[model samples]
Target chain A: MLLLITRTFKESIRSILRNGWLSVSTISILVMSLYIISVFFVFTSTANEMLKEIKNKANISVYFKADAEEGVILAAKTEVEKMNEVKSVEYISKEVALENFKRTNANEPVILESLKEIGGNPLLAALVVRANNPTDYQTIDENITKATFSEEVSRVNYNKNKELINKLNSVIETIQKIGISLGLLFAAISLLITFNAVRITIYTHKQEIEIMRLVGASNMFIRLPFIFEGIIYGIVSSVVSVLLLFISLKFIASYVSLTIPTVSLMNFYLANFGTILGYQILLGSFFGVIGGLMAMRKYLKV
Target chain B: MINEENIQEEKNKIMIKFDNVSKTYKGDFMALEEINLDIAEGEFISVVGQSGSGKSTLLKLIYAEEAATVGEVYFDGNPLSVVRKKNLSAHRREIGTVFQDFKLLPRKTVYENVAYALEVSGAPDEEIAENVPQILDIVGLTTKAKKYPHQLSGGEQQKVAIARALVHTPMIIVADEPTGNLDPIASLEIVRLLIRINELGTTVVLASHDKDIVDKANKRVLVLENGRIIADYPQGKYKIS
Candidate 1:
């Protein structure tokens, strides 16, 4: 068994060396496919991170009626906090609201003078509520509207930003759908090309395969060499693609960071390096072996 | 009485038996018809015929490369078709095959080509290392073992084919017009080698259309005509006239 494996391995390598052009072309196709897949992986992962950041920052600020009691406003905060969708709630007291307003307009002397002339603070206490997910904001808004303290609330701010939030979510979802479909289309095209390439390779060796069969070689003994050749193709292409991906990621990391600081492609790749490598190797080899097996099907009928 | 005769025949250690064998292709074209023959152990037989005379088909049936369309082919008393698909190789290992075109892997050297036969059959590394050179020596290709098929003469390539066929020490060697690609001199050389291999106790089955070589062989000859044996001569000469 050991000798058989060694011989198969030797023959596989010899075949690859013998057919240098075919091996190169096949490996190039594999690398291109794997590179495209890895790129899409990085794109989707980065997009996902950006979406999460945007969702985490999304919130609604609900102000109380200017004449409402402070205790009632505090009660609204507690009530909103109790809701399942609400991630957190922070209360801005009347004093803090006035202070925030003044600090925000500190550079505007005219606004400061107007604020002093107005004498009493015109701000209202409000509760800022954040939801666990962007989609949950609508539910939280509906719940707040029907709450016992709804009358005391001057306005629910979620309705004002609802369209913007919905538009962002929809756009992200559309991008994700298009990304997946395009990725699959690219993969299918590459796999088909690789399959045909392997078929041609086998076609060139049709005589060799026939001779092997004539020499009383078992089906598996004949098959193993081709299978090993395919695996070598996969491994070689995967290593090249991964190394290329890593180098390109490193080269573009700083530029990407400058433009889209919310998500770092390099960091994502580095953090999941093992997983990325494993995925590429597995996918690459699967495609290679499947292509080889498809080609071998017709010829092994001997 | 026929059954009794068959029992006695089986007792004589017949290596191959064809009983009313017929092969039809695509439902209409008959490749072989009602063929019956018996080959004993260590016999050298020549099958001579024109093209499409079912000579190749007969050789194929013996190794179960092609099944008899309507009857039985028995190798060492076991029906060829009854052998499971997985066990076909084991059966073939006992029978080496040589083809007209030589069928040597162009990329592999002569030594590698011969070694490949043993390699595929899972021979030990040491055995292959020891036996390949010995076989090459027997085929008179020891000096040319390092050369590729394209580098060797037609005769040398056929010698390599014979060496590959001999490496497994098969009980029977089947050659299908093995000298078809060779010159007259090379063809004669191959015939002599086959005769020598037969002398060493291996059953040799040579299929050929070359009248000079076949007539010179002077062995048991089965002349096939349109998938039927026209004559079986104990020591035949090619009678083209």
Candidate 2:
């Protein structure tokens, strides 16, 4: 069987090479489907990565009582830091908050003088708590309240920003879920189209297959060539898909990076070159074997 | 000789047996009926009949290409009627089939066409490289081994088909109007090739309508008409009228 398999592979490759137009047509179809799927995969994954970055930028800021001492807020920061869900805790002192306020409002003279007229820092000392994941905020915020210095806290400022974060999280999640579902559906459809293309090509050469069968060729022996043809189809198409992707991304990607100001397709594809190649090869080979097996079914039987 | 065949008819020594074999197409038109025949090993025979007669049907039945409505066809020791589709390849490998159309793979060259049969049987490259050229030479196509099917003349293509048929060196050769497309000279070339092939001690069962080639063979002939074997002779002629 192993001997037959190798022979089939060699013969299949030979057959494809001999049929110039056939080889071209099969490879192009395979490449087209693979390229479409790869593009969809890149788009959704990049979007997910960008969304995660945005989530990491968010935090819960708890403003303390105006009369509360700075030491109490520092204690609150330490307590929040010790909690399992808390990713990080930073205490902003009243003076620091006042300076930040003045710096932010420097362009507005009325607000700046009003701030000087007070002749004092009129800001509350606050602790900003960051959670490991978006959903972790609820648990960690509750832990902040159960701490010994809860009286010093005027309110947990998380109450203000919590609703906005929750809404944003759901929106991001929904987009990812839809992207995944659509990606899978399209991938399956693409695979089927690729398979059918190979099947049709084999059907066209059915006479050749039957002749091969009649000559005393084993089923496995005859199947090898088809499988090899499929692999060749897969490799050629994946290379085409990748090149088309590269050139298109090379042109359209710069424009996209300029408009979006987030992801750089060139850099991403470059950074993940090995991963992309590995993925493309695996995809091409998988589709090729499947397409070949399915297409060669009739010929392999008798 | 006929009496000797009849005495051994009930025994299992025959290589092929058609027991009450019959075939009818979609309509009630019977293509073949009550086809009881036994072929001994290494016998070179020809089946001669008119165009609509059951000659081709008998050949197809011997290969089990069509099922008989009433009986069974036994090849070697196995019953073809019940042989699974998966086992068809093995069964077909035991018999080389050549058609009037030649049925050579257009894409394959003469050498490749001949080697294809061996390739399917998992023969190694050395064996293919060795056997194919030799068989082509045997069919007298050694000089034209590199030519594709289109490049060759009808006689040459038939020779390639013959080469393919003989490559596996099977026990029997079932030819269905093998010379149907050829001119008289080309047809004789084919007849000569079949004769030459038969001389190698392989059983040759050809269904041909050409009067001259059948008259010249002078071998065992089975004549069928209206789906029945109307004549059996040690030597026979094309009785189309």
Candidate 3:
């Protein structure tokens, strides 16, 4: 049995190689599809990261009365932090607030002049609150309102950030949904194109297939090389696509880093590679092999 | 009725015994009808008939190319109709075939073509190495091993086909007009090659229309007319008329 199986395997490999450029062309198609899927996922991940950064920048600060005691402000901060929706809260005393204002506006003449005109430190002690999810800022604002020491609070300032944060959340959500839907759609299309290509190759060899059946080739013997061919296409195409993607992204990231000085494409690529590698293999090789086997199905029938 | 054990004993060792098999093509045409034949081990039998006489049909029955429309064609007392798909390769592997048209794989080298049967069945590399060349030598195909079918002469291609048949050391060789593509000399060469293979203890079944060749074969001949066997004789000479 071992002897027979091995011989069949060797013959199948030979038959697959017989198609020459036809097999290569099919593999090329698989590579293109896999590359498209990989790049799309990369773009999706990058967009996700950008949206997260936007959410991080949308924190709301609540000011307390100047005369409010430290215990009251600390209690308010703890109460706001304990809310189910609120991510975190930190109390800033008047002195710390004033120092922060000076540090931030040191290069701004208008802010400095306004501060001097107010004579003493005009800024109030505040508690800065951030939500776990950007969309939940409204719940945080409401929780802060019903706090035990709401009477000590001079003003709650989450109202201004609420609309902007919600808008950002919706936009990011739309992007996520669109990316996933389009990614799956195109991956499915790619799988089909690759499958069609392999099927055409098999159809051309239909007579030879019948002959193989007549001569007593087991299904595995007939199927093995074609399967190998598909896997080979997937692995080869993925490597090509991945190398192209990485090189192109690295070049673009360098330019973006120089110009924007804020958007770090290199950092994003490095941070999310575990996900990218998995997606690439899933899209390229997994899809490629399935396409190949599906294409070979009709021909493989004895 | 007195020998229930004898029936089991008979079942164990019959090489090929077709009780009654008739194949009819579409419409009212009958390709074969009511054929009863028994071929034992190591028999060099040639099926001689004109076109449409069902000689090819008989070969097809043994190869299971087409199922018998009525009655049974048994190989070693096993039903051909109900052979499982997984067992198909095993069943076909046991019987090597040479086609009238010399159905050598056009793209494969002669060596690869000969070794194809083994390859599909996953024969080990060392065994393939040992057997393919030996079979090629047997068919006088060693020199043309690397050439593709299209590159070789008709005789050489047919030789490759014969070599492919012999590679498995099958119980029988069914040659369906294997000389149809060759000239007189090439045709003679193929027939002689079949004889040589038969001498090596492989059962040979040759189907042919050439009067001169069948008359000279001097082996068992089963003559057919209109899908029915008209004659069967040991050491038979061709008498198509």
Question: lDDT winner among the candidates?
Answer: 1
lDDT of each: 0.86, 0.78, 0.78
lDDT of 2 by residue, A1-302 (tens): 78777776776766677667756776776676677777766665666666576667768888889998877777777877888888888888888898899889989999998888988787888888888888777787787788788888888766344565667567667766766676566556646655665666577667877787667666666566677777777787778888888888899788989887877877777787777777888888888887667656643454
Alpha carbon lDDT at B75, candidate 2: 86
Model 1: share of native contacts present?
0.76
Best by DockQ: 1
Model 3 per-residue lDDT tens digits across residues A1-302? 66544554454456557767766776666666666666666666666666677677777789888888888888777777778887777778899989998999999999899899989978899988888887687777777678788888888776465575567567767766776776677678767866876686577767677778778887776666566556656666777777777787898888877875767776776787666666676667677678877877754565
Tens-digit per-residue lDDT, B1-241, candidate 3: 6598788556545577788888988897899889888887778888988898988989988988788888888886788887643477888888999987777778789998877777777677689889999988888878888898889888888888888888888988999999888899988888888888888888888999987677767798999999999999888888878
What TM-score does model 2 achieve against the real structure?
Answer: 0.79
List, residue by residue over B1-241, the lDDT tens digit for candidate 1. Answer: 9999999776657999999999998869999999999998888899989999999999999878898889899898889888635578888888989889888988889999999888888888899999999999999999998999999999999999999999989999999999998999999999999999999999999999999899878898999999999999888887642
> Model 1 segments beyond 4 Å from truth?
A65-78, A81-125, A159-164, B1-11, B150-152, B183-186, B239-241
Which residue window of length 10 is worst by lDDT in model 1 chain A? A159-168
Ranking by TM-score: 1, 3, 2
TM-score of each: 0.86, 0.79, 0.85
Q: Report the Cα lDDT for residue B231, model 3.
A: 91
Runs in model 2 lying further than 4 Å from the true structure: A1-7, A14-29, A66-125, A131-151, A159-196, A250-267, A288-301, B1-12, B24-30, B68-70, B82-84, B146-153
DockQ of each: 0.65, 0.57, 0.58
Task: Give the per-residue lDDT of model 1 (tens digit) for A91-159.
Answer: 998899999999999999999999899889988889999888777888998898899999999987874
Off by over 4 Å in 3: A1-28, A105-121, A146-148, A159-164, A177-181, A204-211, A254-261, B1-13, B24-30, B82-84, B107-109, B141-152
True contacts kept of each: 0.76, 0.86, 0.79
| Candidate 1, CAPRI quality class derived from DockQ | medium
